[model samples]
Target chain A: MTNTNRRVLLKSRPQGEPTPANFDIVDAPLPEPKDGEYLSRTIWLSLDPYMRGRMAEAKGYAANVNLGDAMVGGTVGQVIKSRNPKFKEGDYVVEYAGWQSHAVSNGAMSMKLDPNAAPLSAALSVLGMPGMTAWWGLMKIGKPKAGETVVVSAASGAVGSVVGQLAKAHGCRAVGIAGGKDKCDYVVKELGFDACVDYRAAGGNLFKEIRAAAPNGIDVYFENVGGAVQAAVVPQLNDFARVPLCGLIAHYNEMQPSPGPDWRLLLVKRATVTGFIVSDHFTDMEGFWKEVPALVKSGKLKYREDIVKGIDNAPEAFIGLLKGRNFGKLLVQVSDDPTRS
Target chain B: MTNTNRRVLLKSRPQGEPTPANFDIVDAPLPEPKDGEYLSRTIWLSLDPYMRGRMAEAKGYAANVNLGDAMVGGTVGQVIKSRNPKFKEGDYVVEYAGWQSHAVSNGAMSMKLDPNAAPLSAALSVLGMPGMTAWWGLMKIGKPKAGETVVVSAASGAVGSVVGQLAKAHGCRAVGIAGGKDKCDYVVKELGFDACVDYRAAGGNLFKEIRAAAPNGIDVYFENVGGAVQAAVVPQLNDFARVPLCGLIAHYNEMQPSPGPDWRLLLVKRATVTGFIVSDHFTDMEGFWKEVPALVKSGKLKYREDIVKGIDNAPEAFIGLLKGRNFGKLLVQVSDDPTRS
Candidate 1:
């Protein structure tokens, strides 16, 4: 029990794009579980675009990571010691442990994960927060009717992949917008999207490309990227189109206030744009957990994860995520595999 | 039977804000009703902020006014002569007659106005398009729940006035944002809003002022003005707040693209902003006509109109509307009182 915990802590606020200088890797004594608390060792860490927002001083759904604090994140871990009666030792659980090797959590903070039923890492990727985000966003906000067209940006990533697949299962023409030909190919062929658009392709305007892809016009735009991508999709939206705004990765690093032509275009199209956090829909998790697992089992839903080898690389993987470098749900393997335990 | 018709035709598109020079006064021989047609002599011509969008070349809900075409508008008029069985001479009706002294209408075009029941001008103001805009926006989009806070911009204008009254009637706390102290006073005292923020008097920091006015946060924002007003209102929006965007008068006349911090802030709030055209909601008019009239008759709703004299002055009145110069529903008295007919 003499293990030392190493973690990345926020060193300073980022001006625009976060640099390595903004983070500090430091060592601390591993936390021991107190009464009513559990000592959890991190197994897999989730790195997401939303972490970029958490790094900023501006107001967002979650508080910004304060200087000298462990960067906030969702982690899948194994409880090694539990003083709480509800959680037993060796139980795999999901917890908000930030960018740390080990954590002390109260029973209230963790959801037990069943590794025997599903892949243990899937709890931090497809079957977890990212999966739930797509479920709630598509089912609740996007509300894609049968035969409708749904377009998602960053389509090869965790949430977008799930969004596209779920939309397909709902009888929609799922269109994926990804960065490169490889991701686009994967989204279309592997994820079963009706079509995929390569946003990085030269000589093709996004609006023109999307318009060509969706002739009847996009019914739902699962907005994860804002900027030129949003501008392109807005005008092509059909009357009463719904935009489930899950993230704005494009402008997360922007130091200056965003320049705009105003959002009057959204108004003129008679479209709806709404933002949401997955936690806001937590009350409906009973319906989500019940429905999603069945979809996964039936192979109606698919997910992908970009796994990093160690906790030390989580910061770099997170930085890559903000730049759209990750091909799937970004996760960091924090410790040795538990199956050998 | 001999009538001199003075019509305002679109002369040229204005570079910025519209001026009197952008329109031309044309005289023509009054048209006669043909088979199944009726002649309508304009009584009150409605002037609205949306007309500014019509004057632009940009694609919008309706086709932009072509040069040399009569400026389109809604008018309440008298059927002076009828060749149609459905309409009779001397019957008051509502028609799309543009800014004109007289018009010839087919039986398919006019809705019989209840002259004895309410002011015929009411058909062009509160009981017609503006009133219906408020009704559909509140009922369909705003969905004002009991105890929710409803906030509207341009609070003394036709749509805003109706929106406030309807919100109050639904047992919500209604807050109004208007330009002047008078309009603010009128909205709170006369229209029954819980409070009103005078945006102009507050030195344009409407965000702070609105927050001070609605400490509970805004549930519904009836957006007519977009720009700083929208920027200010967006942050104060409560979770699941509904913004029924009826107009963007603030940006309508500007030729250059509006510079800004991007509207992507809309994505983080989990709020919905949707645009609507009243004409698109025409299918629901029977419901509106039935409910609104009852509310008006029961003294639960009140309306106001600013009547400008003469058809020749419609262009000036319309220009004034874009500047927020009109206190209520701006209308032109196209002909002498048809109630005396």
Candidate 2:
């Protein structure tokens, strides 16, 4: 086996939108697991918007990824060797392997993944962190009841896609807000969202379209995109509405202050807007893993993956992610998936 | 009886700060009680910031008041004539009687005020809607726990004054934000708050003072005044903090857009900001009336009333309330309190 390992590291903090120069791909010798540890090979690396927040120097919900350190992320991997009784050779696991070709770990922070239960790549996409983010925020925070209208922004992206579907399952009229007409169509047609508003059409008409779709007024806003989309949604919220704030993807690249409505509007509606990180409520994770997989297996829940081939394309793919270029859950296939192959 | 009733009506909607021209004092013939109704005379008229929102053309949580309608408000009055068996002459009651000398009401919308339990005028202040507003928002929404820090804005106003006192009772560290040095002094020295920051001291140092006062960080913010006060408190909120949004008096006279921090800050701390109206949770009113007055009577709760004599002064008093010129709950004595006189 080739003993060469490669990693992508943050070269410098970004002022606005991140460019390739802010990151550097470096090669090193492959790491080996000692006693009571396991060696894992990365198969799929998840790319999410929250990664941008981690790249900055500012303190956040999590620790900032230091310059020259591997950009942090979730990964679906194959365990090649195991020194502990908890694992064996040819086993799959979900881990925080960061942006690397291979990793050596004791498996304490990793969850064993079952390839036969669903596709192995699903662990990095729908069946993993991003999926949990959508579920927890919508279920616990948004809490859209029957007959209420639920609107999800960035509707074709990983978290937004699942949020809209969950809103549907909860007996709500689901509306999607996506950047383009095609993504909007996919959200409405494939995901069965009640309606999808194309935000890229015209800034002035976006609210009108959303208003038309959710005639009852928005009861739950699963906020994934910030800026104009949130500014539009704030006025449309119903009294006693709930907003589960997940990500501010639109503002992730923004250098200037984001434009929002007079926050007095939130007071006018008696609404609840909460900023939440799923990690704070991981006790609910066990329940999510049990419930979500059953729904996915029964075709009651649908997830789409926008998979890019090879580790070399990760930087470009992630850059495109912030611009809303990729649809559904964005992931990079760093190595061949043995189960799929 | 003179049989002449004095009333204040909305004369014109102001573009910014409301002036005397926006209100009119006129005398009209008092209407007689019909078969199912009773005639009542206003004794104490409550002037609150919410009335400013009702004067505007835009619709809000409640319906907008038309130009010629009597300015809506809560009033403590004595029934002069009763056609219904539930009420009798000389019995005191609290009702939404507007800014008027007389009211005709069926028993459905009014609560019988027990003068023996508390002072008749107390029904219009601490024992009334303002008191209930403080209790419900602080309990149901803010939910401050033991040792946690609680901050109440508009610290010397009716709702905020009670919010800070109640925070102390609940074993939480109570901090306040008021407009003047005197008000800030009264809040800490007289009202039992741990600390109070004067928002009007200077714009540059208000946030610094608030941060210093709440050295442990804020866990619950009872938001009565929005604008800069809210923007300052946003950075100090702890993870999973709650904000009970009751009113935005600081922006009540604002003609231009009110400035607040980009709300993405709410997403950072995983905090909850919920807007609430006391009217929505009136069932809790019974509990508030029972618990709060007991606290007041036992000296556990301290209340200050800044009462102005004559209904003619209500317009100026209300304007002063908006500017934080009045130190405590601002009310107008419309007539002799029959329970005392």
Candidate 3:
């Protein structure tokens, strides 16, 4: 059979913000399944802010996506053909298939997904990396005690939304900081955050707003944005407060080191700030599977996805994700499902 | 009896670097000991970096030295007279007597010094607050494991000297970062550090020096100087490394907010930086007194003191301390010992 597949590759590294010139869409031959490998057609692709770090040449938790390579990503796919005994033709699976319409995997790095267990797209979102990030960061780093205030930036987005909900479930006073009024309202009204600060509004004095909302002081600052917002929230942190440094989306596009008053004050206050990548904690997957699913099942955890139809729109959707245009977990639906479509 | 005593009080708040105008030396009446009290004559007065924080009006862990109050300090003094059963005439003790030649205190905060047990000045240096700062910061925050590489900045200073020794005793590779070759040599030869980086000679290439010294990456950073030195040491920290931030002498004199490319990148490396005042762990003093003195007796730990003579010289000594002019634990020899005199 003739092989025909489309893929998005990193054509060049962007100096600052990624533009269309940074990526190239091209048609390619889909590979045949080798021994112990399975051929899969991409059903859904995840577009995350961390992808920006992967595109940069700087040393990060992971290696940079090399030029002329398909941009790396988390994808949920349908097994079209299989040489591996664990996966069969017509099975659904999740894998790191990049921005490709199809891929061949050895099944070692792939997990079987039962569409009947949950929605297929959930494999790329709430049941996936973003969900695990929120679980570990809130539970391990944030450590929100009962009635303690947990302030999360990017409040209505993927990890932050889940973090706020999980914190609420732990009997914490959840406060959200989001850019727009709409996102702020959603976080407070639907996600049950006690207060929501609209960072985009006029007279947006973050220090004032945070102090007003959390008079007792912030116990856990779930840091996602790391420029001026960090400067404001840091002073309001109580002694022994914990900060889970999940992502610095604000400085991801910076070509030069961002200017700042040093964070030595964080040390003075006896506060703790830690960074983590979810992949490093794969050893804790058993514990995660045991806890997160129950939280989701009981509605103690919730998630949302902004789905764009077709693989052709993946690059644009990813760029928008970094710019905070997407309300929640950003996903590109790459194919029609016989079950849903 | 004639009441003639020299006292130094805070005349005004400093705007940038403290000046002689900010302090007033005056003649005051010798305070009489009340019931359950003792009148103490200052002998050796401690001038520490924490005192700088106390001089400021800013809200910190400890109360600021109020304007018009005698500048607060730790002192090794002699109880010239006592009204309490716990003390006797001519008893040597340690007290919080500020920069004054004479003062009265209730037995509440005085620790009787066993003049034969250790040097009287040891009560203010290696055996007292500075030593405790190192003890708690290392055992509690730095948590150095055997075979780990521990890096301490300000290596010849009071706290740094103790930290380097303790790390060496714990079987960690103790590397120090000090301002000059002399200080670096003192850290390596006298203080028992495995290696020492001369931060001054490092110029703008401190990161390179740190990388060269700690090829395996640093597991504990005893952070005392927090500016360019901190920026250099951070990138060399291993994942899950601990930083005990005891001081920020580099920025202590600044009136305005410090300019910076924020060191939040340090947090993103999965390292923990924690600031603490030694007093917060007063509960741990029993444990420290049990451990540190034994280490000192066995020749496993070492310390140094820079003693300036006379109460009149304290302001200069303190100012010099801020500029890194005074080496090791800075102290003022307030008066000639009447017994020796």
Strongest candidate by lDDT: 2
Lowest lDDT 10-residue stretch of candidate 3 chain A: A259-268
Span of 10 residues, lowest total lDDT, candidate 1 chain A: A256-265
Model 2 segments more than 4 A misplaced: B286-290
DockQ of 1: 0.65
Candidates 1 and 3 compared by DockQ, better number? 1
- Per-residue alpha-carbon lDDT of candidate 1 for residues B1-341, written as tens digits (9 for 90 to 100): 55778899999988899999999999988987899898888888999988888888888788889999899999988888889999988888899999888898885767897788888888877888999999999889999999999999899999999999999989999999888988998898888899998888887667888998899999999998877777788778887788898887888888866653355566567778788999987876886877899898888899888989988888888888888889988989988885754
Model 1: per-residue Cα lDDT over A85-197, one tens digit each: 98898998988998998999996868898877888888877788899999899888899999999999989999999999989988999999999999999999999998888
Q: Write down the TM-score of every candidate.
A: 0.93, 0.98, 0.95
By lDDT rank, best first, the candidates go: 2, 1, 3
How many clashes does each candidate structure show, in the order listed? 2, 0, 2
Instruction: Write the residue-wise lDDT of candidate 3 on B252-282 in tens digits.
Output: 8887666543444554477777778888887
Off by over 4 Å in 3: A285-287, A338-341, B260-264, B285-287, B336-341
Off by over 4 Å in 1: A339-341, B259-261, B285-287
Across the candidates, what are chain A's individual TM-scores?
Answer: 0.96, 0.97, 0.96
- The digit string of per-residue lDDT tens for model 2 on B210-250 reads 88999989999999888788878988899889999899888
True contacts kept of each: 0.87, 0.76, 0.63
The CAPRI class of candidate 2 is medium
